[model samples]
Target: MINFNRFFSSLPLLLATLAVQYDEGKTESNAERLLKFGNSLLAQGQLAEALTQFNSAVDNDPKNYMAYYKRATVYLALGKSKAALPDLKMTMKLKPDFTSAFIHHGNILLKIGKMDEAAKDYQEALRQDPNNQEAKTNFESIPALKEHIIDAGQFVKENRLTEAVDYYSRVVMYMPWNVTFRALRAEVYMKEGSYYKAIDDYKSITKLKPDSMAEYLQMSKLHYALGDLEDALSDVRECLKLDQDHKQCLPHYKKLKKLDKQYSQAQEFINGGRYEEAIQKYTKTLDTEPDVPLYKMRSKAKICHCYRKLHKTVEAFKICNEVLEHDEENVDVLLDRGETYLIDEMYDKAIEDFRKADEIENTQRTEEALNRAQKLHKQSLKRDYYKILGVKRNARKKEILKAYRKLAQQWHPDKHEEGPAKDKASKMFMDIAAAKEVLSDPDKRQMFDQGEDPLDPEEQQKRQQWGQPFGGGFNPFGSGGGFKFHFP
Candidate 1:
């Protein structure tokens, strides 16, 4: 009966102890459950939710190494690589030989562009567990990094530049020490027409390797395309500084210099309204690069226009003629010369030039010249008909007609109004009628062709007096009614 009280008291104490142990076990299980949930979320890319679960697990068991490691992974997933650093270090301290933790820590350092620290972490991971695949892969990846870079180069060549950029970005992210990735990415950026992005990448490359001409040329070309001519000029000059006779860069440098000067002069001339003088300046620009066909053609056209405005037709014609002599098929010069000929009223010459001009295909000036020449030729023919008609040396056809009509009407004096002028008019009229008849006849027209003037009264009288009677001896309308005038 004395041992019952001691037994009861011990029973209660034992029950309490068991309850406390059970509670401790429950707490640890709940913490493990939270950690597992967090890891699942992380693997599924639900980083924020995983972070919440990881934070709960860490709160439940502050010393849980896996919780720390999982929380660090979530941080990395969330792009908070710096935030993951201390958690990784804590994970390593909690479990020193944790191979996966070493890999995660190194990877976080790598994400933050810290290659040396990341390499150390990877090495330590490999040493702790020599057969760890993740550690081995990360370690082996460093030496084969350039091969990855060359793969990216091949991607660029294939014009899979977006994918190439991804590969290059990976190299840049994993091996921040090697700048070739950045440089390669810059080149791809240029190909993609992302000039500003290329400039930024090129700037990084220049910082890494100061003596690279390729970077400078890329930057210059980009600047030029963007119309930042001054910056383009600066970059080209810097490129030349790297290699004085760099063949690729020399042409660009020369082009930029020429463009700069032309832009300045053009602005100046436009503001001054000195168009003719400006044209002259532009003409002089062709001297810098005469082999450029566009420059020569433009200069010739402008100079020709200046001559035209100054009313210097001959000068314009001369220049166009010279150009045509060299390039007979040059449509612009041919059209221009045709117009000049029309302006000079050389209508036949203008028509010929215009016909040649029209034979040139598909030009505005050719059409214009053709139309102008046709119009002027029609007008010229109408204005100057005398050259085609061939009238006489000096005789008035009206005076010749009047004298012949009076002689024919008076020879029959019964129809004539008469006085002392009547007999004279009749005899003179007969001679005049014979003269007019001979001149008008076609056979006498042949006689006139032999240099005889049939309109001369004296020649007509000689022919009448010498005319022979061929069929019969008969009196005709002559000086006497019984006397016949005959000639051999």
Candidate 2:
């Protein structure tokens, strides 16, 4: 975490020491001084150090377009295209007539996969700097890509997908910077049911051609097919943001809204100890919206979860395997399958799936599942407390408390009927409470964090003698850990 960039960033004296003297009668502020020095550092190819100076300059004078432009330039050099976006946008807003800024920003956009946005920026650059070679080359390449795309489309319509794919991929390889060409190839990939490759292309296109409703719609559908409901919903929302109320978007928007509601209702039912009802609702939702692959697969996954909770292991395993056959990399289905395996005492099988899930996405939930799977396999009760709270190491007191409270409400036994749901909730409620009690105390937390069990019998006895004892885990502490999270 040591910021080496800080060394050359704020040290104004370094500039003079290096023979980059300030001009006489310069009455500019610290930010202006920093900007000039940062530009010089950039020219010298000291990128990281230059970034630090630019950051300092921005902190001192946020209104300085020159500082933003310089910072954006550094970000571009570092291949951090997204990092450059806000600064480049601010630069454009502050100095619309700066043709070079437009060209540079457009190129950055192109590199980052915002094809449509980059095209617009390049066109603007062309209007202002007609003879600009970079802008002209980029702008002119787009139409040629479009022509190639049309030829590829002819092959697509004739059901000659292999030829279409071959042709498009070749064109994209040649016009590597023409993002649209890659997008066309991605569409062909999707048609061929090469979902993983198509998803990859969709991801790039969405990033590159963000404002284009076509790209968003395509990505949304692909993600939906892949059982990535949240990503699908996100793409839909982004499309809606651009189109407002376009006719093509309204149906998708409405369907997603309904699906979201149905999904939430099913979750509530599950939490309320109505597993059968939840399954019914989930199934109904799936049946009603089979077009949205996201809802269909997720509903199936939830059905598996419900079956597992209901101790219908055979059914749960069956559904999970069936779903996996379609979308093998779905983390949620993998997690559910792993859980079912764990419950069946198939710990190795559980661990294998959980490990794969964790490798795909290093989420807190998956890490705990992985460890807990291995732990039980080894006959241990040692929980990964940090993973339990959905946090990492070095978490502050308030952060621990916040996570604890959120999970407490989420798994409150009172929310469920007196059954397996309640039993599971009761166990987790106690564990979360115990985790909070141990982690909230400074000395106990330090001990726990340093590989010592603070809840051991000897420590418990000492605490009881000191007029304190661990409560039977029943109380619910309450806050949420997610904003855009949805159970798959």
TM-score of each: 0.34, 0.41
lDDT of each: 0.68, 0.77
Q: What is the lDDT of residue 419 in candidate 1?
A: 87
User: For candidate 2, lDDT tens digit of each residue in 249-332?
Assistant: 668878777877888899999999999999999988976697755567778988988987776889999999988998899898
Q: Which candidate achieves the best lDDT against the true structure? A: 2
Candidate 1 clashes between residue pairs 3 or more apart in a chain or in different chains: 407-429, 466-486, 466-487, 467-486, 467-487, 468-487
Let me know the TM-score candidate 1 reaches against the reference structure: 0.34
Please give the lDDT score for candidate 2: 0.77
lDDT at position 38, candidate 2:
81
* Cα lDDT of model 1 by residue, 21-49, tens digit: 46555665767877766666677666887
What are the root-mean-square deviations of the candidates from the true structure over C-alphas? Answer: 25.3, 20.3
